[model samples]
Structures are given as C-alpha cells and as structure tokens.
Target: MRMLKRFFLIPIVVLVVSCGGPELPEEVALEYEALPKTLDFNQHVKPILSDKCYLCHGPDAGNIKGGLQLHSAEAAYSELSENPGNLAIVPGKLEKSEMFHRIITTDPNLIMPSPDSHLSLTNKEKAMLVKWIEDGAEYKDHWAFIKPEKHKVPKIKNEDLVANPIDNFVLAQLEPLDLKLSEKADKETLLRRASIDLTGLQPTLEQIEEFVNDESPNAFEKQVDRMLASEKYGEQRTLDWMDLARYADTHGYSVDRYRDTSPWRDWVIKSFNENMPYDQFIL
Candidate 1:
C-alpha cells in the first residue's frame, strides 16, 4: 500500500514541478533592421503637417497663426528660415528653431494651435519635427526613398551575456555611444514592475505575497493574463476612449446642464471588451 501511494505521488510531484518551471524572459527584439539616420522634410514633414495643421495655416485662410503658413513646401521653408525677429527656424539647430520651440512650449502664449483649435500633435510627431530640423531640414521627394534592407545581426563581445535579442539591439546602439546597459532588476523590483504594467494600480500586500510565493515558471505571465481578463481593463479602456472623444458628463455652455452620457460610456466599454476593431468604431 505504501509503495503504491509513493508511486502515485511521484507523478503528482512531477506535474507540480513542471507547472512551476521558471518562465523565459519576454522577447525584446527590435523588428526593424535599421532606423533612418536622417529625416527628409518634404517627404515626411510636409505630409504630416498637411494632414494635421494645414486646415488652419494653409493658403486661402487669412488667419495664419504667428504669420506662419505651412501649406506649401516653399512657404514653409521661407517662413521658418527667414526670421526678421531672429525667431525663425535655423536648419540643423533645434534651439534656434522658433517653430520647433513654439510647438513644444507649454505656455499658452507660446504654444501653437491656439485655444480655438482643439488639436495638438503627439509627442512622437513633435520629436520627428525636431529631428527633421536637426537634420538640416532637408526637403526631398517621397516614394523615391527606399526602405532599409535587413542586415546580419551585429556581433557583440558578450553575446552570451544577453538574455534576449532586445539587449542585442540596445547594446548595438549603446556601443557607438560607449554606454552600458543597466543590470537586471531584482526579483522584488521585477514583480512590482510587472504588476504595475499589467494593472494600473500597485499590487496589494496580499497579492504581492501570493505572487512571491508562487513557484510556477509562468507565474508572472499568468498574472498578466488574469489582470487583462479583469473588468478593470475594460473600465480603463473606456476611460481612454472618453479622453480621445473628449466626452464630459456636463454641457459646457451657459446653462451648464448635467448630461447623462453614462450609457454611451458603458457602450464604449462593452465594445472594447468585445475586441471591436478601431475601423468598425469609425464606421
């Protein structure tokens, strides 16, 4: 009887051990082979400005903000470079580019798009603009530029030391700068980082304790999956949609009447939970 029980327990132990195996680190590899060393203005910058900013500053509109017109490539170059007050863009210099400065400025007086316009370019867009100016604001035709070709992954001295491919890409860039990557975070730090990233809120003491005690290899991934499946994910997504739509519960005009838009809010949340494609939402 004792032998039979031990034999049965061996399989149970193996199963538990297998389930608790340590998970491999997530892949951090860069998909792109290369990033553009220089930015072209006419190709990249013109198209972006035309779609987002031309409505206000384009030709046929007399109200050119700060006497600037970004409608035509020539107009944009002339207005930006010819600074009578020494306030225009000096190609290859960001600090000298008043156009770039105004876009990034938080002060209402210096900020672009003004109060009347609700649109604002994202940080990524602003960064691209700054890079373009830094790259001498070179204007070139679009579609003529070819996409970068895939090259062999560059060799690093301590390739064995790298836990994932992302490290390789990062180290490759850092190598040129003579910089080193930071050390791997501690277990506590890793857990906290994962928890906060997976769920917006910090983990509770009990939850933290449970995760720390869990010996399963895929424990962190399991926690991530669980959090993503929770109702809070839907709620947070709903809040994101609300921000994008600029939805408010009250009308802004004189009467300032309270509006019952909670139903619509709930509808957005439901759509997100159902994994509705963004194109369908627009339709």
Candidate 2:
C-alpha cells in the first residue's frame, strides 16, 4: 500500500515542479529533462549581460544603479543589502536568485534594466541566464584583462608530419573529427602566396622560375627573407596605420590643399623595414 501511494505521488510532484515551483525533485529527476545545454558564461551569457546590465550595474561608480555591480566576478555574487533583494546571485538555485527573478518577472516595476531605462532582455537571454544560475553561475576574468597562458603542445599519432608546436595543436584538434592538414603547396604556388602576402603583388614570372628552380632545403625560407628585405613589404604593411593616422595627399577640406605628410609616411615604411619594436614604433 505504501509503495503504490509513493508511485501515485510522483506524477503530482513532477507536475507541480515543472509548472515553476522549485528545483527538480530527485524522484522524477531522471524522467524530466532540462532544455538544451547552453550555459557558457563567457560565450553566451557575458555578451547579454554586457549589453543589457553593464551600463547601470557595471564598474562606473558614478552611475551604478541600486548599489549593484555586475562587471566583476566578485561584485556579481555580492549581496544586494541596500536594494530590496537579498542575494544578487544564488548559484545553483535559479528560483531563489534575485537577479534571475527580476529578469523573468512580468511585473513592470520588478523587471531588470527597468522599462523606464528602455533596456530589456529577450526570451533567449533570460533562458541562458536561468541555466547559468542553475550551473553554479561560474565567472571568468574579463577577456581584455585576462593574461595569455602558454599551452603545452598536444602529442598526436602522426608525429613525423608535425612541422611545429602550432601544427601539433591544430592536428590534435582535427584528429578527433577524422581530419588532417592539407599537403604543402608547390614551390611556384608558395612563392606567389608569399609575394602577395608580403608585397601586395603577385610574383613576376622570373621570380616564380627562380623559386621553382631553387633545390636547396632552405629555398622557401630564403624567398621569405628576400621578400622581407623588399621596400614593397614595408609599404604594404604600413597602409592600415597610415589610414588610422589620417595621412592624405591633401588636407581633407572644402579648400583642399596639399599636405607635407611624406616625412611621417616615410618614417612608417622605414620602421617596418628596420623591424622596429612596437613600443618604439608608436613612440
């Protein structure tokens, strides 16, 4: 009789929980499935928070709303003592979390970004936030502030084929998916690729013949060194920076007049050829 009674109660409990009650009850946990797994804090959740919440809740001390700060990992998890809510984030508990509640609530006064502030979260963003909260609300350092870490090269079966540590890492990723790197380009094709990349121009027929005929083991490296020595390489590299510096043949005005910016332009081209350190180049 007790066994039958417990069996009968399972459906009722599941029904109550599913219709927005509490966390999944352990009894029906196996049967009930969550929505598709999409709870990455960095990739999915961060962009939504940055766009919607950061303006009012972010690092700018002068404009923080409700004494909440969501910019840093520390602040997001902090308690909203001054505000009406208690905890801003109660990890692994979405229903009890105030941030999650404010976003999901239909009440105009309770919704986040506030209707008066003209900011709102889409259904998809709200779902992501819910899942993030349920997944322990893990936080990562802001991407700009994160320091780069050196990764150990992955060991792969085709050790002989690996050209460098970079190739080993790339091949390791591809190995799981049954893919491999394509074959090396022929000499003529390689020459053309290098020329265009370094000088912004295709290799001449004479240059192509010279590369194709070179039988030395260091032939490709020699060709690369030669291209780097060319004036065109410097000229091609500095085009973007020149544009950013607003270098032009003439002053950009209605009464346009020629400008003497050649000295600055020449300095850029010279800096590239000399392999100037980035800090010194900027200085």
Candidate 3:
C-alpha cells in the first residue's frame, strides 16, 4: 500500500513542478520581441538611393556629407550612434531619426549632399526605409539577399470601370488611404490640359474646334493619341533625350573646344521620328 501511494505522489509532484516553472520578466520578453527576426538590406533600403549618393557617401568615397557613410552596415550604424550633430541615423527609431528626415526634406539647403545630382528618393521608397529603420535596422546581405517570389495582380470587383493596369495598382494603394480617383474633366478642360501637357503649349482654335466636333466617347483619347504620333512630339522627345544624354553643340574639354556633332544630333532626331525604343537608341 505504501509503495503504490509513493508512485502516485511522485507523478503529482512532477506535474506541479512543470506548471510552476520560473516565468520570464515582462521587460526581458519585450526586449526579445523588439529584435528583428531577419534583415533585408537591398530590397528594404538600397533601391531608395542611387550611385550618385554612393559617390560621396560610400566606403571608398570621402565621407563628405555630415560624416555619414552608407557604404556598409557597420559604418552606417557607427554614424547613427556617434554623430556629434545627431543628424544622420537613429537606429530602431524612425520618427526621431535624422537620416529619414534628410531624405524626405523639401528644403533645398537641407537636402542631402547639396549637389546638382538629379537623383531623388520617391515617397514610397522613403516610407519603406522608415519602416526598416523602425524594425531595428538589422544588417544583412545586399542584393539577392532573399529569393524572389511571384507577385499576382490583385482582382478588382468592377472590371468594367477599369481603364488600365496602372489604374488598378494606384487604386489598390490609394484605397487603404481612403482616397479615390477624381472625376473626369469636361471635354474642353481635357483638351486644354492634353494640349499643354503633350505639346508644352496651349491648343490652337482649330485643334479645339476639331476636338469639340468629335462626338465619339473615345474622341479625347484619339486626339491625344494623334498628338503623340505627331512630328512635334518626335522633335520634342529628341531634344529631351539630347538633354538627358548631355549632348552639347561644343566639346567639353580642357580648352572647351567647339565640335560639330550636328550630324549625330540629326541622326538622334531621325531615330525619334522612327519611334525607336530608348534602350535600343542607347545601344
């Protein structure tokens, strides 16, 4: 009887010991929760900036702008914690972070690097970076840090109302923000807007008359399409491409020599008329 009672009592003691084991402090549990499970350096951050920024802010380059070098994870964190002005990064805190503030800044004087570089961070990119910083700024591998996953196009309820896939993408994001597309403008308003946007000038009386006369629902689209197909569009596109390519009438050398590249310029204009894809033209 004594032996049987001892066996049953042993089981009860084990159960009680397991159930009443030591508990972790709330603060310690919170600390563990705060740590990021993983980090994505490339997708989360790198695409937000370009090589133009890397020129001065990279490891090899001189740390010119606010002594903040974003070349490596170590360097980035070091600057964040040790900056005298406290104006670069603030790890694990996005709102109180100075790095984020600089990127989203509209003030020309406060802009990063203060250079003529045309590279600008997009709003979406800024938001992603802020979220990343808030998530502890975990250091991980660069590009291809993670395997790519297939993305599916989201389904919309009103297929009849959809104009384009771009609209769908815009709507998907905007819906969460409680925003909707603005109502379509009147024909006259649209024609004026289209003319200025397409040709960089106000519509002529004849153009306006033709647009007003057309009764088709697709008239405005057709008119804009026609304008896009015009020789004027080709000419403007060529000039714009030239500006992008930084082509000048004269050679930029030590002596600032004058060189005739008119034949090349004409060739570029002709290619535009042929509706050459920019990538092919670049090649």
Please tell me which predicted candidate would have the highest TM-score against the true structure.
2
Looking at model 1, which ten-residue stretch has the lowest summed lDDT? Answer: 24-33
In candidate 3 the C-alpha lDDT for residue 271 amounts to 83
- List model 2 lDDT by residue over 19-117, tens digit each: 555543343233234334545567888898889998988889898866688877688787654544456787887656667657755556556868888
| Top candidate, metric lDDT | 2
lDDT of 1 by residue, 134-182 (tens): 6777655444344555767767777865876767887887877788888
Q: Mind giving the per-residue lDDT tens digits that candidate 3 earns over 49-85? A: 4444676676664354446677666777663333443
| Local lDDT at 87 for model 2 | 66
What would you estimate as the lDDT of candidate 3?
0.61
**Model 1 Cα shift for residue 73 (angstroms):** 10
- The reply for model 1, stretches above 4 Å from the true place, is 1-161, 251-255
C-alpha positional error of residue 62 in candidate 1 after TM-score superposition, expressed in Å? 8.8
lDDT, residue 66, model 3: 48
Q: Candidate 2 lDDT (Cα, whole model)?
A: 0.74
